[model samples]
Target: MSLSGETIRKIREAIKSAFPNRDELVMMLRMELDIPESEVPDGSNYNLVVFNLIDQLDRQNRIPELIKGALNERPGNPDVQKVAQEINAIYSNLSDKPLLKSFEFDVVTVNAQGWKISRKRCRAQYFTEDLGNGVTLEMVAIPGGTFMMGAPKNEKDSFDYERPQHEVTVQPFFMGRYPVTQAQWRAVAALPQVNKELKPNPSYFKGDDRPVEQISWYDALEFCARLNFTINVTTQRDYRLPSEAEWEYACRAGTTTPFYFGETITTDLANYRGNSTYGNAPQGEYREETTTVGRFPPNAFGLYDLHGNVWEWCADTWHKNYEGAPKDGSAWINDNDNPILRGGSWGNLPVLCRSAFRFYDSWAERDSHDDLIGFRVVCAFGRT
Candidate 1:
């Protein structure tokens, strides 16, 4: 779970650039990693001190956590931000690609009866797409696996559309680490149009890091098309919305629970309306607006905003049920005008945010967009 040496070097450079003063760097590390002041390696040479601290954190498998914390703590520091993006891109272009690089994390599971927390580990390969202007998109590698795709008959508030609990075999692919952000949307929007024009700023909640909402399914497809045209010169993968089966497989992250974290969700874990309770979990804050991506914890596969933040657009057309659905994880398309949406939004009740829950845009209109909807992109596995 140790970060690659190149990643360490980039991080060190970013740290040095962001905090030139040795005392400031040490203090930032202490506060970010919760390391005691006395425990920081004592050295007059700043580089050695910083290297020692990074080495210790890497050995503890906290490098990902450290990078994320650093970025969140100093959102304005372009140097630190670039380092995070570069590190993710570095893994993809290495001469000797290490596809097995792994990480460890803790996941929570809750139910009407009670709650429990446990440590989980996963191996992932990821690459960052540089969208220009210091904006980047991190795409995590989801390994191929088999999983049941729908809710069981006895699950609480389960829907008929999510029925029969069929098994689906999904192929490995790369998924955006978080939903597409406003900065990323603007960058991609600026790219030469492939099919349709794009509005640079469509999100109601305005932040560079916040997920870009008010996007139609057609708009999402165009974003992927434009991105594919830009990135395919070097990497031949196609960028597109994930198939519904792949979305559920990745969201579940090897779990069968109603949600990735567990049987029920709490507002503490997502951005949905928290005034309403789910299972035994008590009612929590209802933010009523989108929050910054990565503000909440990720699932086991290192994906964020899978359960909430905003309902994500999926590739499949609307289907009444799992009956005759594609078992091979391809998009289920058949001339249906309505498109599917998953992973409920900030304004939705907790029940709608379950991993198995399903929603569709208005049947009459295919061009609809709103603040409650956004999407992440996926790249084919072998092409990269």
Candidate 2:
């Protein structure tokens, strides 16, 4: 990606203003590109080579203004012939509407070849629509942000595993509004699995709306991989389990309370242990099984069933505490054998549903016995 000619001109002016002398500006620009000064002039020197170098810099949009400023100022000892030649060479390289910045400031869509780029707003738009198989799935658009990932020591209703809250920054992404349901699972499993062992059980919960359970992490990964291929997205961040940090962050939205809805969870709010209550709430309904997604109001971020319905898998490897965890949203997958799990199960007490709750399970293992374990997937924004 390159900068426009007008932007290049402005950049040249800025550089000249800052450096004053052409020779000095040439040396500085060379230093910036990590190119040696000895390689210029006879071997691409300032008088002979700087214009093209500045052009390249402008194309990259890294320090265009800086280079432009240097070029605009005509040195008293003019090398007019060399300057004109260099300028002509560099000018040809400018694109019609070049993109200078390497890092994407805003979301953008590029062609499959990854050449053309277009600004993308509403990178993700969620919906709840029937899959035409008598099933409905809830989807959410998750904007990226930075937040404390793990539970703090003083975190109320937090488990020992969730201690020592750590900061985490996540890139924008999209997530399913709720756990995958039994109907969705069966539909996918019915397809011939390359590995027969990976096939889902027919006897598992079959409700079209109820969250799916008895699935292993490996199974979920395969589903996500298939989905990614099907969607044909350019993003390397595929649809997969949310990291442990991401789960809690999404669950809490922005609240410090035990649950996303605040301190209390009543029967009308979520599905959890009926006998147990949090935040002075009356007992809730102990459904003893997963409920339909979006049965309750969504959190501030418009995510449904983040606290209850089923225990959701996260990408992080299990750790005793948040000590020495990564500040980024990436899972701590180093030398660890167990992946983290978050959100309380349908059978869990309200306290377990707290956003800070955390648990561990073998990554290569399965949660076949637990009817309350399920998963949702995430994809980078604009992937769809």
lDDT scores of the candidates, listed in order: 0.80, 0.58
- Model 2 misplaced stretches (Cα beyond 4 Å): 1-124, 127-138, 191-197, 200-203, 231-237, 361-369, 381-384
- Candidate 1, which segments miss by more than 4 Å at Cα? 1-104, 111-116, 121-123, 361-365
Cα lDDT for residue 383, candidate 2: 29
Name the lDDT value of residue 210 in candidate 1. Answer: 95
TM-score of each: 0.72, 0.61
Candidate maximizing TM-score = 1
What RMSD value applies to candidate 2?
19.0
In the range 1-384, model 1's lDDT, one tens digit per residue, is: 456677789888877777786677667767766767787777788888778878887788666556655654564577776765564454345343224334555555556543556545554567777666688878888889899999999888999999889989988888998999999999989765657999999988999999999998889998997675444423445689999999999999998888888878887689999998778888789998999998876888889999889989888888899899999999998797888899999999999999999888564135778899899999884533
In TM-score terms, candidate 2 sits at 0.61
Clash pairs, model 1 backbone:
none
Candidate 2 lDDT by residue in tens digits, 124-149: 24644233246544456666788776
Query: Could you list the CA RMSD of all candidates, in the order they appear?
Result: 12.8, 19.0
